[model samples]
Every structure is written in structure tokens, then in C-alpha cells.
Target: MLAALAAGCPGGDQRSISGKVTYDFVPATYSATTGTGTLAFAQASKRPVRNAVVQLRQGSGVIATTNTDEQGNYRLVYIPEDDSGELSVQVLAKTSSPQIQVEDNTDGNAIWAMGAKLSGTDAESESGTTLSLHAGHGWTGSAYDATRRVAAPFAVLDSMYTAAKAFMAVRPVSFPALKVNWSPDNVPQGGDKASGFISTSHFSPAENEIYILGKAGADTDEFDSHVIVHEWGHYFENNLSRSDSPGGPHGRGDVLDPRIAFGEGYGNAIAAILLPESLYVDTVWSGSGGSLTAFGIDAETEPLDTDDPTPGVFSEASVHRLLYDLYDSGTNESSYDKVSVGLGPFYDALAGLQKTTPSMTTIASFITALKEQPGVDSAAVNTLLSRYNIGPITSIWGEGDSRMFPMYFSVGSYPYNGTLTLDGGYEYNTWYQNQYYVFVGNGSRVTASVNSTYDVALTLYQQGDVLGGSDKTTSGTESVSLTTQNNAIYVLVVTGFKETDGGYGISISITSP
Candidate 1:
């Protein structure tokens, strides 16, 4: 959908059109509670609508197309195909290059936009025209109206713009196309996505789409800049970096799998790194009309949950705080926050070294490589790691920890038989929940089997890539067969289907041709 505005005509021999675009958004109160939160907003301020599609239109048809730059300015020059048609400029809720669209899920995926036109003789001006258009927040004293609701998509755009610019500043790269699904009907419910039941604001790796909540009187995220950047962070990690996390319900204080810890922590920290403010805030009202600002996290200064029994390498709070401290400039609140190598070094480790590391993606793996990056202050990194009681990550496989040392048992010869115990601790689908063994393949078809006290699962990996896996519903044992690749080293992972109490046995033998 497009809304129209007015523009001034010019007098130039060659026809040319140029202008700027902007949008308004209501800002969220920092660390707001019901007692401090209010519906009143200061909406006079405007921000440049960066990187959106801008079109020069004649009457109802598009005559030329361009993109708004970082300053929200665009210029178009084209020969007149028809002198009688009215001239106009249109800015869409979409961007060029790696396209990103904010769609109305409740409707038929309509793209919102702002357009401005010159009527009568102004349309046929010999010179050029300068146009300016803006998208309003749609707030009419008490509530937002339909016509003024165009700002949501552009607000989402601004956040994406901020995030993209931050990464490009740190490194040179192109982003993949992405679509953000948002609508007034989008709600926090379990149902069809098109029907506006967005469930929550999250990125779907399978669909490569982001779903945002947008129920007017209830939970709406159109103005939640941090939430938008947070989800975009997930998209970046999945596409640019590596994410081995098994998705599940997790919380700030919960001790999670190392993969989950890193994935979630990175997602949260990217927001702090990109946003002007380091505070992560989300606002929402309950369906019953109860005003409840969702949550706020001060990644820079929030105190860790001291009561959590296991808070070392398995905590997300520790992971994100560490990441922000690494890139953030000027750290004085704590002596441990001394390292300030900036986003470049961190980006290098994440996209280059950490991507192909043999270990499962985790905080330990990321920080281990982060310290190894050239010119990094390893002593500062070590000091920061010590603050969380996690220090000297010598290996991607998490060395130095007694529970993790001798990470992979080696089976040098054929007809290998071994029994591994994971009594240290077991949380279903966690990094420590499974045991690993390494062996050189002999180019013959082989069967790898695992027998355990509970339902068992087996998986094989070669150089950080999955080779084979077997997950049978039946309990007790599981096996997978794969032909060997000469002398290539392979890692076999064994785990119980359910929570495990103790010992598990593994057998790898050549299978008959």
C-alpha cells in the first residue's frame, strides 16, 4: 500500500528528480516498568529511511527505479516516456541488492510505502522536481489509526539498516535476501503463521523468514528496535557463522548447552553492539489489557545470577556479556573488561576460524579462536574469561576442564571396541550429554553401533561435517553404516535417547561388501 504527499516543481532542460525519505517511530522507555511506562510519546523526531527502494513514477506506472543511500536521499534521471502523465516518486518498504521486505501477514503480504506526486503543469515541468515524503507513527492522541500504521515496516527497516551498516563497517560482505513477516493481526499464539499467529519474533532458518508480533492493544514489536536486531542476529549466525544448537526453551539464568549458550548469547550481544544503547528492551501488553513491558537486559552491567550452581562455560549471560565487553570501547566498571579489540577481530574469528572448527559451535570454541586471532590482547581475554571462572581454552574440544579433557578417545585399528562413561553430568541435547570417539577409516563399508542403558543414538562427523546418523525409536541400541574414506579421521558421537544414568558401549567393525 502507498500513501501520497506533495512536491515542488523545477525548471531544467534535462528531466531529473531527487528527494529524501524519512519515518517516525515511538521509542521505548529504558528499563520501563508499569509504574513508569506511559502511552505518551515524543514523535517529532525523524530518521533517514536508509537503503529502501525508490521509484520515479509517471501516472500509475513506474518510470525509473533507484535506492535511498545512507542519508535517505535518492536521485533519478530519465527521459519522459509520456508528457501527459503525472510525475511522482515512490519509496517502498523494501530494499535493493539483498532484498528485505516487511510484509503484512494478516493481509495478502502487501508491502507498505510512501509516495509523492506533482499535479497539472507541475507534472510536465521542463526542469526537475524535488520531493520529500515521510511515514507517520499513526498515533492520534490515544491510539494508532489505520492510515498512519505505515511506520511499522519502515521501523523494522531502520533496525535492519543499523545492523547491516554495523557489520559492513567491521567487514566487507554482502547480505542474503530476507523477509520480515509482520501485521496488526500477528499475535503471540500457536497457529498458522499467515493467520497472524506469529508465536514470537524469531528467525526461521528453514524458511529464511522472520516473524514479528503485531497485535495493537496486546504485544506489538514495531517499535522494539532491540528485538528486531536480536532476531537478525540469529539470521547472521546461522547464515554467516556456524550454529549447532538444538533449538529449545531456554532462559537467561538457565545453564544451557554450550551451543545454545553461544548462539543465544551472540544474538543478544549483536543487538547491544549495533544499537545506540546497550540495553535490550521489549514492550508488550497482556491480552487482558494489562500493561507489561516484556523484559530489559543491561548486557553491559547486569549482575550474574550467583545462585546458579553451574555458571561457567554453560551460561548464556556470561557468554553475551563477554562478547559485548570484547567489542565495546572504554570499560571502566570492571577491571576484567579490559579487552577492546573492536568488532573486526571478533568478526574474523566468527566467520573465518570458528566456522570450520572441528568442535561443535560453542562459547568455548568461539573464545578459544577469538584469543588466537592476530594482534588480539590474549591477556585481556584471559582476564575476562577468569571473571567467569572459564579460562585458558586451549582446544576447540574444550580442553583443561577435567570433565572434558581427553575429549575424543582414539581407535587406531579396525574392529574397535570401547565403553565410554558420561557420569560428569547429562542434560538432554547438551554438549556434555554425549561422548565422542575418533578413528581413521579404512575405505571399507563399516557399521558403528552403540549400546546403552537407555535408548541410544549414533552420529558420525568428518572435519566438522555430518557423515551419518541413526536415531531409532526403539531403546537400548542404535547403529549407522557408512563407507570409509581411506584414512580420513572420523568422530563418532554416542548418546542415550533419554536422560542417561551411566555407561554406554560402542563398537565399530567393517561390514561385508
Candidate 2:
């Protein structure tokens, strides 16, 4: 679930403190067309700190607090009924959660640390009701001041901006400002994971939103650059490029859909590229502290290479490994190590050719674009692709595969009929899918049907664009008919339910009168 926070109110207190919270950082140079720029790490400037925790205090006692909005503006309201004629309040900023709850809350064991006192104000109750104060770098010290524990948001912002800038550095296309929502209230209540609505952190594609969970003193995400970049990578894929990933619960070893494999694997690979870090870490918050796990692409420890002997065509590990090998400049023993094509070629391919490829968005489509990219060596590309068991990519349509058995059939004339058997089990059907290609004449009405021993689904496509599909009927039998122009190519895809496979017979007939 999304974080929903209301404004803070101190009842019976007739005065209010309102202000803005901001931080200073070096912004990268950007271009919307060429994506070439440099990082101004030597200098820095100030920008509003959004969703920061701001608090109001009365003589070391807590009164009220609220989070800064997207614009970094915040207001704390108080009633001065019982206080003296003048009320003095202290305004402070912390790097941790402003609202930490122990039970029945979304934020679990969250914290607000690395605090700096912003200002102190004295207001005449019921007389001078409003005062303005701004909390930022200069308000505490120099413009480039570094305060430990309180600069978590700085790291988060830096990683996000850096990644976006890197993208622009390659293919300078303008994208909308990303909206990030964070709060200490984004935790599960009473350690019940099921009742929790929001994840620790994730990128929502439909809403174009980023959510960060602030579990005070427990788990926090602002410090994990790899994790932040990984999530941002998802935003890049969905918004800037095209992703047909069927969203679901996936893990490292799961046999994923090809689309999901490509999307997840690309996200992982891009994180490492943006940061150029060998160790990728994810910190999980538990009680008072957190534990982290790290993985790598080229190294033996936590390597992207899979242990599964029969890791199929839809393995995320293979996709990420191939991508990492292609981008890594280090002279590792990997196949593509000699040819460090860098992130620029990959970005160009994704934003240009892969966006509208005729085939499904998979490793094949990406490799097809990569081969077409200028300055890329085809021999090195084949070496890396073949090493990952994805087969040597001979064409974008995947015509000549040395491994995993490539299958495609053509229909040349009307009244053409054929019989094919589909099987999937521990021994017979180890993989998840079976596909065939059909070609037909213009204005031809083509009808195809399937009869199988297990529940099956049928999808018809031209290139990668899905034209028609069927799964509504029962008993594993389905038929579809379509009419298109002369010599149009279509792919017939059939699969069992939940990766289950059994014998099936399919027949196709075409007529053009």
C-alpha cells in the first residue's frame, strides 16, 4: 500500500512554525538528445529536500511534526492555550523517520538519525500566530557541510540523479520528474508480513511512482546505492523503453517468462553499470538493525552464473550475465571482456531498435539490435551469447540456434494441414514453451485449433506483436481465425497451464478465394 500521511497538529497551541527543508548536491550535466554530460562532483548547490522529517519541540519535550511535501515545504500547527504568554519552540531535522511506531503500523522499527538543529523561535500565543523558518545546509553551517547519519536522503537523491544523468549521457531524451514517496509509517504492524501493504521499496509503473520505506533503527534504504539504482532501473525500462514483463513473484532461480527475465535481468545489469560497482548489496531491516547480501557478475563469489544444469531460455541469470559480460571493461576471463562495448551501445540499442522490434522483447531482440550497432564486433557478441547458453544469435527472429532446439514451420499454400505433438514433463517437456511460425497470403482466412491432454493456451502473433489469442474454452482445445494481407508472417504459440506439458495435436488450414 502507498504511504498516506496527514499534517501534524498540536491542539490548544495557538501558534505555528512553517518552513522548507533542502539539501545541496552536485547535479550532473544533461542533454535530452545525445545524453552526453559530466558530473560536477567538485562543486555543489542547494535543492529542496522532499519528504524529510521536520519536528517541533517545547523545552526538550515533543509537540508535533510533519513531513515535507514534494516541494520540501512543511508546517507544524500548535495551540498555545496552557503555555505562558510567549511560547518558544525548537525546529530540528533528522535523517531517520519522524514517526516511528512499534505496533499496528506499516513502518517497522524505523529510525530518524543524523539530526541537526535548524532554528529556535519564540511566538506570542494568540498574538503573533505564524513564523517562517527554512531548514537547509546554510541554516546549520557551510554550503557543503557533511553531517553523519542525517544525510541518508542525500545518497538516495545522488544515486537517482546520477543514473538518470547517465541515461541522458548516452541518449539525451527528456523524461518526467520521478515522484518519490517515503515515510516512517511504511511498515507492517506487529511483525505480520501478510498484513503489510507496502514493500520495503519498489517502483510502480502504472502510477510512475517510487516508494521508499523508512523503518527507524531497523531497515532503511537511503544508504544502499545499488538497491536504489536497481529500482530506478525498473522505472527506466518501463517508462523510457518497452517492457512486456508479466509482473509476478520472481526470484534468482525461478524459471521465468522470457519477458520477465529480460526486464529483471536488465534492471540488475543496469544498476552495476550506473555505479560500476562489483558488489551489489541489499540491506534488509529486522528489529533494531539490518543485514545485507551482496552479489556480483564476473567474480566466483555470488556469481551471476547459474548452478541449475538445465537453466532454460527464460533464465534471468543468463540474461544478466550476458549483459554484464558485454558491459564489463575489466579483463576477466569472460567472453566479452576483450570488447567492453560499454553502456552507451546498450542504451542506444534499447532506446532505438529494440523499442519496436518485430519479435518479442527478449535476449534475442536485444542481441539483434546489438549486432546492428556500429563498432560492435559480431564475433565477441556470439562468444558471450553462446557462453550463456542462449545460443549464437544468428538473427533477430532466432533462425539458427546451436542449442535449445530452434523450431519454425511455414505454410506456403491453401488447404495446408499438419500434425504436431506437444509434451512437457520431468523428462519429455523440461522447458516451458513450444512455438511455430506460419506464413499466409493476403486476405487469407486462416483457422487453427489445438487438442491436448492438458490445459493449453494458444497465442497468434506476427513478429513479436500479439495479434490474437485464446484461453477461455475448456478441456485444452481452442481455435482462432484471422485474415491479413499477402505473405504476412504469424507465430503460433501453445503452452500448458503452469509449465505443465503433455501431448497435443494441432492443425492449420488457410483459404483465399
Candidate 3:
């Protein structure tokens, strides 16, 4: 259900006020090829503040209240008694939604608002009375004035409204409560959330909060719709689908952990799909708010040729491009991109097979699940996979791909040598930095060991659920023992902390007794 808005009483001497709300949105100019762009206040665009609460207040008491429609238009009717108090229109940076609240994390977590005074005489002046209120970006040609910067929170709220609409378009949703913390004091520094050092603009699954970078003259995401929706995509995946990604720093070109690539790329793809355009722009400010730079990319047209050098299943660039091609009704540059399943079918895969698969949520798992759904074009989908060199998808475990990709190792092969090494340029968070082994538990205790010069981290899981493992900080032999169920499949992962000091050598073994 939406908000419990008051139904205004209209009878004799019905006084009403109808109006529209709008905000200033700055635009960015980007290079389609390199994704570099510029943004300035001079090019600000006016956009609607939709799905927000609009109120007509009489002095301190509220005479009538209503919600803005999709176009930021609202109408409120109130009966006139004695002209004892003044009337004003107040708009809050909150939605009666699929409830999303944009709060000032630095200032008591309060919802932001701006007001316009309305006279009672004007309320009943005519049959169709209207009022217009707009929020400005507060730029004074040289710099920004914080007091006049009232549109930032409203801009952020609009993105969430767009995301809710995109999801509800496909199916009815009873969206859970969500809080978005934003403030001019929010920065990338790590500290208490109240002080506004949010670490970064990201969605925290632990706190169930999305923190947006709001420090001026550094980086602010209020105007960046893609960044907002990208984080929302994370929340959607966390709430609805399954995410096995070990979150960390990732880029478009780099090879990543399979789970991370799919997660990040899906975030990028969701922004492209839900936003008004396919272009994704993330803006950054220099030492002064007057100087702004942005990075833009076209998810629908980015190419991944056969000769491109990077991780195949581990490239977020490949993941987003493929997903955008699948959903958008546009022509793609990739020769293998002939499939268009749209968002509804794409979502079907996420809420269905992808959620329940035994394997970690990777592209292989998602694509395999997507193909299993009804009415999806299988042959065309395979063409796209073939271009990326992704193996044939038949199972959530990437059926028959281990021969070439070697994603999984067999527990039957004892005294196995792991091939994952610590390269000087490689970070420890990537898929190539770890090795995985799978085996069926015999309803008995099983022991696993990894011998290495550096710290060896080992984690065990059963059907995507974490069990228990060991990751000793000291080097030598890292071993873990655990009991397993009969015929239940279990996966063990080993990551080396060599730090490019030596080879990624470590004999691994798993035995049941």
C-alpha cells in the first residue's frame, strides 16, 4: 500500500491548491568512445520531483496533504473555515512509496524539504488555482553556495522513484523500507556514519543502507543517476536474487572474480536499462566545485572482440555490454548479439533459477538459468556467449566447461597442485587469485589442507551456504576439518597471500574418513 494520505473534505467553501514541483538537473558532456566528460552548472536542466509528498499547511497545523504524481503535479482540496492562519506548500524529499527516504546523515538523519508560502485567499481564488515551486543547484558562476543547494536530495529521490517504477512495470512489488543517507558532509573517509564519512557511495548489506558520496569539491553522486541506480541494483540483488560476490575494487577492463564481475556489470546494466538513456555517467569534482569531470559509457554498444585481452567470465565490461544488448531494443556492434529478451524475461531468470542455483551467482549460473526459462531465444543467446568465449551453459556449475576453463577441481584427485598464483600486478580479490575444488560429502568428517609459504585462506560451502573454514594469518600449512552430509555437494576455495613474493605453489588435499 502507498502512504496513508489524508482524504481532504470537500463540501461548502472548498478551498484547493494545485501545482507542479520541479528541480534543477545539471547535464554532462561525454566522449562516446573514451567515457570522459565535463559538467557545469551553466547547463543545468529542469526535471520533475516525482512521487514526493506535497502538503498545504495552515500555520503549524496541516490543513491538507497529497502526493505528487509522476510528473511532479499535485492537487489538494480543503474547506475554508475562518481565515485564522496562513497557508504554505511544503515538499519533502521523501516518497510515499515503495517507501524510500533520503535523509541527511549528518543532521539527525532528517528528511530534506523546501517550502512555499500559500495564502488562503489564493486557495479559493478560482476553480483551477496553481502554484509552482522549483529547487535550484545553487551555483554562482564561480562556486556553489550551500544554503541555496536544495535540489540534491530531490534529485536522488527521483532516481529511486525511477527504479521502483522499472521493477513494478514488470510485476507488482511490495517494496521493503529503505533508507538512503546523503549530506554535503558525506565523504569517502572511513569513520562513523553520523559524521558523514561514509567510506564511499555504496550499499551496505549489513546496515541495509545506501550511502551516497556527498562531499563537495571532491565527489558527489546526487546528480549521478547511474551511480544511484547501480547501488539500487545491488539492493535489488541482495533482497530478491542471490549474490555470492566478494565485494571489492573493480573496473571495466580488469579481470575480476566471476561473482564480482556479474554483480558489478549487472549494476551497470540496470542503470542503463532503467534510466532515461543508455549512457551511464559518473561525475567527479576537482578541488573546486566549479570544475567537474565525468566518465560516460554506452552499455548497449561497448564491444568485446575475440582478440580483447582480459578475463572472459571475469570482465565486468563484457557482462554489462552483453546484458544491455539482451534487454535494450537497439542494435549492438558485437556480431553475436542477436538476442533481445527484454527486462521482464531477464528478471524472470534472476528471481527464478539464478536465485536457487547450487553454484555461486556468476554469469554462467545466470545465463544457464535464463535459458531454462520459457520463451527465451536459446540459439541467439548462445551466439552472444560464443563471442565472449563463455562455455556452453547447461548447469549452474558451468556444465562441461572445466576441461578448458578449469573452474572446478575434483576432490578425487588427491595431492592436487593449485595453479592460482600471486602476480605482481594482480590483486588478491580476483577469481584468478583463487582455486576451487568440489566433492560429495560421505556423511563423515572431511579434512582439507593447503601448504604454502604465505598465508593460505580456505573457505568451505555447501550449496552456496557458508559452513566453516580457516584462514590463518601465519604461513605454513593451513588446514580445516568439517563434517559433511551424505551425497551433499561441497565446495572448498583456497586463496594464497603470496603477494608476488614467490610462486602460487600449495599442495591441496580433501579426504573423507
Highest lDDT, which number? 3
Residue runs of model 3 more than 4 Å from their true location after superposition: 1-14, 33-35, 59-63, 79-86, 123-129, 287-290, 302-308, 331-334, 400-405, 412-425, 445-447, 476-483
On the 0 to 100 scale, the lDDT of residue 288 in model 1 is 61
- Each model's lDDT comes to 0.73, 0.56, 0.76
User: In candidate 1, which residue ranges exceed 4 Å CA deviation?
Assistant: 1-13, 32-40, 83-85, 105-110, 290-292, 306-309, 331-333, 402-427, 430-440, 451-456, 474-476, 486-513
Ranking by TM-score: 3, 1, 2
> Considering every candidate listed, which one attains the maximal TM-score?
3
Superior candidate under TM-score, 1 versus 2: 1
Off by over 4 Å in 2: 1-157, 180-205, 208-224, 253-257, 285-308, 311-313, 331-336, 404-430, 434-441, 444-448, 460-466, 481-489, 498-513
- 1-513 per-residue lDDT for model 3 (tens digits): 011122322325776788889999876567865647865677898888888878777756777788899888999888644664677778878889778878888877777787887665675586756888899988677666888888888888888889978878987776778889889889888999899888889999988888998877878888888999999888888787878787888876677878788899889988888885778888887653347778777775546453135636888877887778777665534577777787788788888877877677888888888887778887888787766667666677777344224666666643344544443336656765666788877778888887766677888877567797788666747888788788887878776556564456677767666
lDDT of 2 by residue, 1-513 (tens): 011223324425356667665554433333323423322334545556555556565544456666667566777777543443333333222222222111212333222222323333445434443443332322122122233223444456546766776776777667665655544445523343323445557777876766555454344555456667878887777666666555555666666656677777787778878876644555443433332222333222233344333343566767776677787775455444455787789888887667776555677678888888899998887776666667777665565454323544666766666666655542212234455546654666777677665566677777556678878765777777787767666666655553444545554443444
lDDT (Cα, 0-100) at 192 in candidate 3: 95
Give the 10-residue window scoring lowest on summed lDDT in candidate 2: 95-104
- Which scores better on TM-score, 1 or 3? 3
lDDT of prediction 1: 0.73
Worst 10 residues of 1 by lDDT: 4-13
Candidate 1 shows a clash count of 2
Candidate 3, clashing residue pairs?
A: none
Query: Local error of candidate 1 at 123, Å?
Result: 1.5
